[model samples]
Target: MTDLTEHEVLVRPRAAPEAPAGRTTGWWAMVLFISTEAATFAAILASDFYLRFSAKGSWPPTSEKEPDLVLPTTATVIILVSCLPMLLGSLAAARGSRAGGLLGTLGAFAGGVAFLVLQIVDWLSEWPDSTVSKDAYGSLFYAITGLHAAHVLIGVGMLAFLLVSLAVRRAAARPRGPVSLVAMYWYFMGVVAVAVYVTVYLSATLWATR
Candidate 1:
Protein backbone atom coordinates (compact mmCIF):
# COMPACT_ATOMS: atom_id res chain seq x y z
CA MET A 1 0.00 0.00 0.00
CA THR A 2 2.96 2.36 0.67
CA ASP A 3 4.62 1.64 -2.70
CA LEU A 4 7.54 -0.16 -1.02
CA THR A 5 8.79 -1.60 -4.34
CA GLU A 6 9.13 1.91 -5.86
CA HIS A 7 11.24 3.04 -2.90
CA GLU A 8 13.46 -0.12 -3.10
CA VAL A 9 15.52 0.09 0.09
CA LEU A 10 18.25 -2.34 1.08
CA VAL A 11 18.84 -3.48 4.63
CA ARG A 12 21.93 -5.10 6.21
CA PRO A 13 22.24 -7.12 9.39
CA ARG A 14 23.51 -4.94 12.22
CA ALA A 15 25.72 -7.76 13.48
CA ALA A 16 27.80 -7.66 10.29
CA PRO A 17 28.07 -3.89 9.90
CA GLU A 18 31.18 -2.16 8.58
CA ALA A 19 32.53 -1.71 12.11
CA PRO A 20 32.81 -5.52 12.23
CA ALA A 21 33.07 -7.62 15.39
CA GLY A 22 35.02 -6.27 18.36
CA ARG A 23 38.33 -7.79 19.55
CA THR A 24 38.41 -10.35 16.75
CA THR A 25 38.15 -7.69 14.09
CA GLY A 26 40.85 -5.71 15.77
CA TRP A 27 43.15 -8.73 15.78
CA TRP A 28 42.56 -9.58 12.14
CA ALA A 29 43.04 -5.98 11.07
CA MET A 30 46.33 -5.78 12.91
CA VAL A 31 47.48 -8.97 11.22
CA LEU A 32 46.77 -7.71 7.73
CA PHE A 33 48.20 -4.26 8.41
CA ILE A 34 51.41 -5.63 9.86
CA SER A 35 51.82 -8.04 6.99
CA THR A 36 51.83 -5.20 4.51
CA GLU A 37 54.17 -3.18 6.68
CA ALA A 38 56.57 -6.10 6.84
CA ALA A 39 56.68 -6.33 3.09
CA THR A 40 57.56 -2.64 2.79
CA PHE A 41 60.37 -2.82 5.35
CA ALA A 42 61.72 -5.98 3.77
CA ALA A 43 62.12 -4.28 0.42
CA ILE A 44 63.93 -1.36 1.94
CA LEU A 45 66.22 -3.56 3.99
CA ALA A 46 67.10 -5.82 1.09
CA SER A 47 67.90 -2.89 -1.11
CA ASP A 48 70.19 -1.44 1.49
CA PHE A 49 71.99 -4.73 1.91
CA TYR A 50 72.51 -5.06 -1.81
CA LEU A 51 74.00 -1.59 -2.14
CA ARG A 52 76.34 -2.01 0.82
CA PHE A 53 77.50 -5.36 -0.50
CA SER A 54 78.36 -3.89 -3.88
CA ALA A 55 81.14 -1.99 -2.17
CA LYS A 56 82.61 -4.19 0.55
CA GLY A 57 85.47 -2.34 2.31
CA SER A 58 83.93 1.03 1.69
CA TRP A 59 80.57 -0.15 3.04
CA PRO A 60 80.88 0.99 6.65
CA PRO A 61 83.93 3.16 5.78
CA THR A 62 85.78 1.68 8.86
CA SER A 63 86.25 5.19 10.27
CA GLU A 64 83.08 4.46 12.25
CA LYS A 65 81.84 1.28 13.93
CA GLU A 66 78.41 -0.25 14.25
CA PRO A 67 76.32 1.09 17.11
CA ASP A 68 76.03 -1.25 20.09
CA LEU A 69 72.84 -3.29 19.94
CA VAL A 70 72.83 -4.41 23.59
CA LEU A 71 70.66 -1.64 24.92
CA PRO A 72 68.25 -1.52 22.04
CA THR A 73 67.94 -5.30 22.13
CA THR A 74 67.14 -5.16 25.81
CA ALA A 75 64.48 -2.58 25.14
CA THR A 76 63.07 -4.85 22.45
CA VAL A 77 62.78 -7.66 24.97
CA ILE A 78 60.91 -5.36 27.36
CA ILE A 79 58.48 -4.37 24.66
CA LEU A 80 57.84 -7.95 23.64
CA VAL A 81 57.02 -8.85 27.23
CA SER A 82 54.70 -5.88 27.64
CA CYS A 83 52.23 -7.56 25.29
CA LEU A 84 50.98 -9.70 28.15
CA PRO A 85 49.86 -6.81 30.31
CA MET A 86 48.39 -5.03 27.34
CA LEU A 87 46.22 -8.07 26.74
CA LEU A 88 45.29 -8.15 30.40
CA GLY A 89 44.36 -4.48 30.21
CA SER A 90 42.15 -5.21 27.22
CA LEU A 91 40.37 -7.94 29.13
CA ALA A 92 39.88 -5.69 32.14
CA ALA A 93 38.54 -2.90 29.97
CA ALA A 94 36.14 -5.33 28.29
CA ARG A 95 34.97 -6.31 31.76
CA GLY A 96 34.28 -2.65 32.61
CA SER A 97 37.34 -2.10 34.80
CA ARG A 98 38.66 0.96 33.08
CA ALA A 99 41.14 1.59 35.85
CA GLY A 100 42.54 -1.90 35.65
CA GLY A 101 42.63 -1.80 31.87
CA LEU A 102 44.44 1.52 32.16
CA LEU A 103 47.03 -0.07 34.40
CA GLY A 104 47.67 -2.83 31.90
CA THR A 105 47.98 -0.31 29.09
CA LEU A 106 50.38 1.71 31.26
CA GLY A 107 52.54 -1.35 31.56
CA ALA A 108 52.68 -1.65 27.78
CA PHE A 109 53.19 2.09 27.34
CA ALA A 110 56.12 2.06 29.73
CA GLY A 111 57.83 -0.56 27.60
CA GLY A 112 57.14 1.44 24.45
CA VAL A 113 58.68 4.55 25.98
CA ALA A 114 61.76 2.59 26.96
CA PHE A 115 62.17 1.41 23.36
CA LEU A 116 61.90 4.98 22.05
CA VAL A 117 64.50 6.28 24.50
CA LEU A 118 66.92 3.52 23.65
CA GLN A 119 66.47 4.15 19.93
CA ILE A 120 67.05 7.89 20.37
CA VAL A 121 70.16 7.13 22.35
CA ASP A 122 71.36 4.79 19.62
CA TRP A 123 70.89 7.50 17.01
CA LEU A 124 72.69 9.99 19.24
CA SER A 125 75.65 7.69 19.44
CA GLU A 126 75.88 7.37 15.67
CA TRP A 127 76.71 10.57 13.88
CA PRO A 128 75.15 10.81 10.45
CA ASP A 129 78.50 11.39 8.77
CA SER A 130 80.16 8.50 10.61
CA THR A 131 77.72 5.74 9.65
CA VAL A 132 77.77 3.97 6.28
CA SER A 133 77.69 6.30 3.28
CA LYS A 134 75.08 8.54 4.89
CA ASP A 135 73.87 8.78 1.35
CA ALA A 136 71.09 6.34 0.53
CA TYR A 137 71.70 3.72 3.20
CA GLY A 138 72.06 6.15 6.09
CA SER A 139 69.13 8.20 4.99
CA LEU A 140 67.00 5.12 4.47
CA PHE A 141 67.96 3.70 7.83
CA TYR A 142 66.99 6.87 9.60
CA ALA A 143 63.85 7.27 7.55
CA ILE A 144 62.67 3.72 8.13
CA THR A 145 63.53 3.51 11.82
CA GLY A 146 62.63 7.10 12.53
CA LEU A 147 59.20 6.63 11.02
CA HIS A 148 58.74 3.50 13.08
CA ALA A 149 59.88 5.32 16.22
CA ALA A 150 57.43 8.10 15.56
CA HIS A 151 54.67 5.52 15.46
CA VAL A 152 55.85 4.13 18.79
CA LEU A 153 55.79 7.59 20.29
CA ILE A 154 52.24 8.07 19.12
CA GLY A 155 51.12 4.77 20.65
CA VAL A 156 52.77 5.65 23.93
CA GLY A 157 50.95 8.98 24.09
CA MET A 158 47.64 7.33 23.25
CA LEU A 159 47.92 4.69 25.97
CA ALA A 160 49.15 7.25 28.48
CA PHE A 161 46.20 9.51 27.72
CA LEU A 162 43.84 6.58 28.19
CA LEU A 163 45.51 5.83 31.52
CA VAL A 164 44.93 9.36 32.73
CA SER A 165 41.34 9.10 31.63
CA LEU A 166 40.89 5.99 33.73
CA ALA A 167 42.57 7.48 36.78
CA VAL A 168 40.22 10.47 36.70
CA ARG A 169 37.25 8.17 36.12
CA ARG A 170 36.52 9.95 32.87
CA ALA A 171 36.41 6.53 31.26
CA ALA A 172 33.97 5.28 33.86
CA ALA A 173 30.41 3.90 33.43
CA ARG A 174 30.67 1.06 30.90
CA PRO A 175 32.64 3.27 28.45
CA ARG A 176 29.76 4.11 26.02
CA GLY A 177 32.48 2.87 23.68
CA PRO A 178 34.44 -0.35 23.50
CA VAL A 179 38.16 0.02 24.15
CA SER A 180 38.81 -2.56 21.43
CA LEU A 181 40.18 0.01 19.02
CA VAL A 182 42.53 1.33 21.67
CA ALA A 183 43.65 -2.18 22.45
CA MET A 184 44.27 -2.82 18.78
CA TYR A 185 46.53 0.20 18.59
CA TRP A 186 48.49 -0.83 21.66
CA TYR A 187 49.11 -4.39 20.47
CA PHE A 188 49.88 -3.02 17.03
CA MET A 189 52.70 -0.96 18.46
CA GLY A 190 54.26 -4.06 19.96
CA VAL A 191 53.87 -6.07 16.78
CA VAL A 192 55.46 -3.36 14.68
CA ALA A 193 58.24 -2.98 17.20
CA VAL A 194 59.12 -6.64 16.74
CA ALA A 195 59.15 -6.29 12.99
CA VAL A 196 61.42 -3.28 13.19
CA TYR A 197 63.76 -5.12 15.49
CA VAL A 198 64.03 -8.07 13.15
CA THR A 199 64.63 -5.83 10.15
CA VAL A 200 67.26 -3.75 11.91
CA TYR A 201 69.05 -6.73 13.39
CA LEU A 202 69.03 -8.61 10.11
CA SER A 203 70.37 -5.58 8.30
CA ALA A 204 73.15 -5.31 10.83
CA THR A 205 74.05 -8.96 10.30
CA LEU A 206 74.06 -8.67 6.54
CA TRP A 207 76.25 -5.61 6.81
CA ALA A 208 78.63 -7.50 9.04
CA THR A 209 78.85 -10.33 6.53
CA ARG A 210 79.44 -8.13 3.49
Candidate 2:
Protein backbone atom coordinates (compact mmCIF):
# COMPACT_ATOMS: atom_id res chain seq x y z
CA MET A 1 0.00 0.00 0.00
CA THR A 2 2.37 2.66 -1.28
CA ASP A 3 0.56 6.02 -1.24
CA LEU A 4 -2.80 4.31 -1.95
CA THR A 5 -4.69 7.21 -0.40
CA GLU A 6 -3.12 9.64 -2.92
CA HIS A 7 -3.90 7.35 -5.94
CA GLU A 8 -7.67 6.94 -5.45
CA VAL A 9 -9.72 5.42 -8.35
CA LEU A 10 -12.40 7.78 -9.76
CA VAL A 11 -15.44 5.78 -10.82
CA ARG A 12 -17.85 7.53 -13.22
CA PRO A 13 -21.50 6.97 -12.31
CA ARG A 14 -23.58 5.16 -14.95
CA ALA A 15 -25.99 7.35 -16.94
CA ALA A 16 -29.66 6.79 -16.42
CA PRO A 17 -31.63 5.25 -19.33
CA GLU A 18 -33.46 7.81 -21.41
CA ALA A 19 -37.25 7.47 -21.53
CA PRO A 20 -38.79 6.80 -24.95
CA ALA A 21 -40.35 9.71 -26.79
CA GLY A 22 -44.13 10.03 -27.40
CA ARG A 23 -44.89 8.24 -24.15
CA THR A 24 -47.28 10.93 -22.90
CA THR A 25 -47.39 12.54 -26.33
CA GLY A 26 -49.37 9.65 -27.74
CA TRP A 27 -52.01 10.06 -25.04
CA TRP A 28 -52.22 13.81 -25.67
CA ALA A 29 -52.65 13.26 -29.39
CA MET A 30 -55.54 10.88 -28.76
CA VAL A 31 -57.20 13.36 -26.40
CA LEU A 32 -57.02 16.07 -29.04
CA PHE A 33 -58.36 13.75 -31.74
CA ILE A 34 -61.30 12.78 -29.57
CA SER A 35 -62.05 16.43 -28.78
CA THR A 36 -62.42 17.22 -32.46
CA GLU A 37 -64.62 14.16 -32.98
CA ALA A 38 -66.84 15.14 -30.07
CA ALA A 39 -67.22 18.58 -31.56
CA THR A 40 -68.29 17.12 -34.90
CA PHE A 41 -70.94 14.96 -33.25
CA ALA A 42 -72.16 17.92 -31.27
CA ALA A 43 -72.64 19.96 -34.40
CA ILE A 44 -74.56 17.15 -36.04
CA LEU A 45 -76.80 16.82 -33.01
CA ALA A 46 -77.51 20.55 -32.98
CA SER A 47 -78.39 20.50 -36.64
CA ASP A 48 -80.73 17.60 -36.10
CA PHE A 49 -82.58 19.40 -33.34
CA TYR A 50 -82.81 22.56 -35.40
CA LEU A 51 -84.23 20.72 -38.39
CA ARG A 52 -86.65 18.73 -36.31
CA PHE A 53 -88.04 21.71 -34.42
CA SER A 54 -88.04 24.13 -37.36
CA ALA A 55 -90.15 21.97 -39.63
CA LYS A 56 -93.88 22.77 -39.38
CA GLY A 57 -96.22 20.03 -38.09
CA SER A 58 -94.89 16.52 -37.28
CA TRP A 59 -91.12 16.42 -36.66
CA PRO A 60 -90.71 13.15 -38.54
CA PRO A 61 -93.14 14.46 -41.20
CA THR A 62 -95.77 11.72 -40.73
CA SER A 63 -94.12 9.39 -43.26
CA GLU A 64 -91.43 8.07 -40.92
CA LYS A 65 -92.43 6.71 -37.53
CA GLU A 66 -90.22 6.86 -34.47
CA PRO A 67 -87.32 4.38 -34.56
CA ASP A 68 -87.59 1.09 -32.69
CA LEU A 69 -86.22 1.75 -29.22
CA VAL A 70 -85.76 -1.87 -28.22
CA LEU A 71 -82.92 -2.75 -30.59
CA PRO A 72 -80.84 0.37 -30.04
CA THR A 73 -81.43 0.29 -26.27
CA THR A 74 -80.22 -3.30 -26.23
CA ALA A 75 -77.13 -2.38 -28.24
CA THR A 76 -76.42 0.48 -25.85
CA VAL A 77 -76.47 -1.91 -22.92
CA ILE A 78 -74.02 -4.22 -24.66
CA ILE A 79 -71.56 -1.44 -25.49
CA LEU A 80 -71.77 0.04 -22.01
CA VAL A 81 -71.14 -3.39 -20.53
CA SER A 82 -68.07 -3.75 -22.76
CA CYS A 83 -66.47 -0.79 -20.98
CA LEU A 84 -66.09 -2.90 -17.84
CA PRO A 85 -63.83 -5.42 -19.56
CA MET A 86 -61.87 -2.63 -21.16
CA LEU A 87 -61.33 -1.06 -17.75
CA LEU A 88 -60.19 -4.40 -16.40
CA GLY A 89 -57.70 -4.79 -19.21
CA SER A 90 -56.29 -1.31 -18.68
CA LEU A 91 -55.87 -1.99 -14.98
CA ALA A 92 -54.16 -5.32 -15.60
CA ALA A 93 -51.74 -3.79 -18.09
CA ALA A 94 -50.90 -1.00 -15.67
CA ARG A 95 -49.85 -3.61 -13.12
CA GLY A 96 -47.92 -5.64 -15.75
CA SER A 97 -50.16 -8.67 -15.40
CA ARG A 98 -50.10 -10.13 -18.91
CA ALA A 99 -52.61 -12.94 -18.38
CA GLY A 100 -55.28 -10.74 -16.84
CA GLY A 101 -54.78 -8.15 -19.53
CA LEU A 102 -55.15 -10.77 -22.24
CA LEU A 103 -58.39 -12.19 -20.85
CA GLY A 104 -59.97 -8.78 -20.32
CA THR A 105 -58.90 -7.49 -23.72
CA LEU A 106 -60.35 -10.55 -25.43
CA GLY A 107 -63.63 -10.11 -23.60
CA ALA A 108 -63.86 -6.44 -24.55
CA PHE A 109 -63.10 -7.19 -28.19
CA ALA A 110 -65.82 -9.82 -28.37
CA GLY A 111 -68.34 -7.41 -26.86
CA GLY A 112 -67.46 -4.77 -29.44
CA VAL A 113 -67.94 -7.26 -32.28
CA ALA A 114 -71.34 -8.23 -30.91
CA PHE A 115 -72.38 -4.57 -30.76
CA LEU A 116 -71.45 -3.99 -34.41
CA VAL A 117 -73.39 -7.04 -35.53
CA LEU A 118 -76.47 -6.00 -33.61
CA GLN A 119 -76.29 -2.47 -35.04
CA ILE A 120 -76.05 -3.80 -38.57
CA VAL A 121 -79.05 -6.02 -38.06
CA ASP A 122 -81.02 -3.09 -36.65
CA TRP A 123 -80.11 -0.98 -39.68
CA LEU A 124 -81.34 -3.70 -42.04
CA SER A 125 -84.67 -4.15 -40.31
CA GLU A 126 -87.63 -2.43 -41.99
CA TRP A 127 -88.75 0.17 -39.50
CA PRO A 128 -90.85 2.51 -41.64
CA ASP A 129 -88.27 3.71 -44.16
CA SER A 130 -85.14 4.12 -42.05
CA THR A 131 -82.94 4.87 -45.04
CA VAL A 132 -80.86 8.00 -45.31
CA SER A 133 -82.55 9.25 -48.49
CA LYS A 134 -86.04 8.78 -47.10
CA ASP A 135 -86.36 12.09 -45.21
CA ALA A 136 -84.72 14.40 -42.70
CA TYR A 137 -85.42 11.89 -39.94
CA GLY A 138 -83.72 9.04 -41.81
CA SER A 139 -80.82 11.24 -42.90
CA LEU A 140 -79.98 12.54 -39.43
CA PHE A 141 -80.63 9.16 -37.85
CA TYR A 142 -78.14 7.43 -40.13
CA ALA A 143 -75.59 10.22 -39.96
CA ILE A 144 -75.34 10.31 -36.17
CA THR A 145 -75.55 6.55 -35.52
CA GLY A 146 -73.35 5.66 -38.49
CA LEU A 147 -70.63 8.01 -37.38
CA HIS A 148 -70.66 6.39 -33.93
CA ALA A 149 -70.64 2.90 -35.40
CA ALA A 150 -67.60 3.76 -37.50
CA HIS A 151 -65.73 4.86 -34.39
CA VAL A 152 -66.62 1.63 -32.63
CA LEU A 153 -65.35 -0.38 -35.58
CA ILE A 154 -62.04 1.50 -35.60
CA GLY A 155 -61.67 0.91 -31.85
CA VAL A 156 -62.23 -2.82 -32.35
CA GLY A 157 -59.50 -2.96 -34.98
CA MET A 158 -57.11 -1.07 -32.74
CA LEU A 159 -57.79 -3.57 -29.94
CA ALA A 160 -57.11 -6.44 -32.32
CA PHE A 161 -53.71 -5.06 -33.23
CA LEU A 162 -52.86 -4.38 -29.61
CA LEU A 163 -53.95 -7.86 -28.60
CA VAL A 164 -51.64 -9.35 -31.24
CA SER A 165 -48.67 -7.25 -30.13
CA LEU A 166 -49.21 -8.19 -26.51
CA ALA A 167 -49.51 -11.89 -27.33
CA VAL A 168 -46.21 -12.02 -29.21
CA ARG A 169 -44.33 -10.05 -26.53
CA ARG A 170 -41.93 -8.92 -29.23
CA ALA A 171 -42.85 -5.34 -28.46
CA ALA A 172 -45.22 -3.60 -26.06
CA ALA A 173 -43.48 -5.29 -23.14
CA ARG A 174 -45.08 -2.68 -20.90
CA PRO A 175 -48.43 -2.06 -22.56
CA ARG A 176 -49.86 0.33 -20.01
CA GLY A 177 -49.50 3.40 -22.20
CA PRO A 178 -51.13 1.96 -25.31
CA VAL A 179 -53.78 0.20 -23.30
CA SER A 180 -54.69 3.41 -21.51
CA LEU A 181 -55.11 5.27 -24.77
CA VAL A 182 -57.28 2.49 -26.15
CA ALA A 183 -59.36 2.50 -22.98
CA MET A 184 -59.91 6.21 -23.30
CA TYR A 185 -61.12 5.79 -26.86
CA TRP A 186 -63.37 2.89 -25.98
CA TYR A 187 -65.04 4.79 -23.16
CA PHE A 188 -65.55 7.79 -25.37
CA MET A 189 -67.24 5.59 -27.95
CA GLY A 190 -69.60 4.20 -25.35
CA VAL A 191 -70.55 7.63 -24.11
CA VAL A 192 -71.27 8.84 -27.60
CA ALA A 193 -73.39 5.79 -28.29
CA VAL A 194 -75.53 6.53 -25.25
CA ALA A 195 -75.98 10.10 -26.38
CA VAL A 196 -76.99 8.96 -29.83
CA TYR A 197 -79.39 6.45 -28.37
CA VAL A 198 -81.05 9.16 -26.32
CA THR A 199 -81.33 11.70 -29.14
CA VAL A 200 -82.23 9.31 -31.92
CA TYR A 201 -84.32 6.76 -30.08
CA LEU A 202 -85.62 8.09 -26.77
CA SER A 203 -86.43 11.63 -27.85
CA ALA A 204 -87.99 10.55 -31.11
CA THR A 205 -90.13 7.94 -29.45
CA LEU A 206 -91.35 10.31 -26.79
CA TRP A 207 -92.15 13.25 -29.07
CA ALA A 208 -92.41 12.08 -32.67
CA THR A 209 -93.95 8.65 -32.58
CA ARG A 210 -97.05 8.19 -34.69
Best by TM-score: 2
- TM-score of each predicted structure versus truth: 0.71, 0.88
Q: Where does model 2 exceed 4 Å of error? A: 1-13, 18-23
Best by lDDT: 2
- For model 1, the local distance difference test gives 0.70
For candidate 2, write residues 63-122 as lDDT tens digits: 876577778988999999999988998899899877667767787798889899989888
Q: Estimate every model's Cα lDDT from 0 to 1.
A: 0.70, 0.84
Please identify model 1 stretches exceeding 4 Å from their true place.
1-43, 46-64, 128-133, 175-178
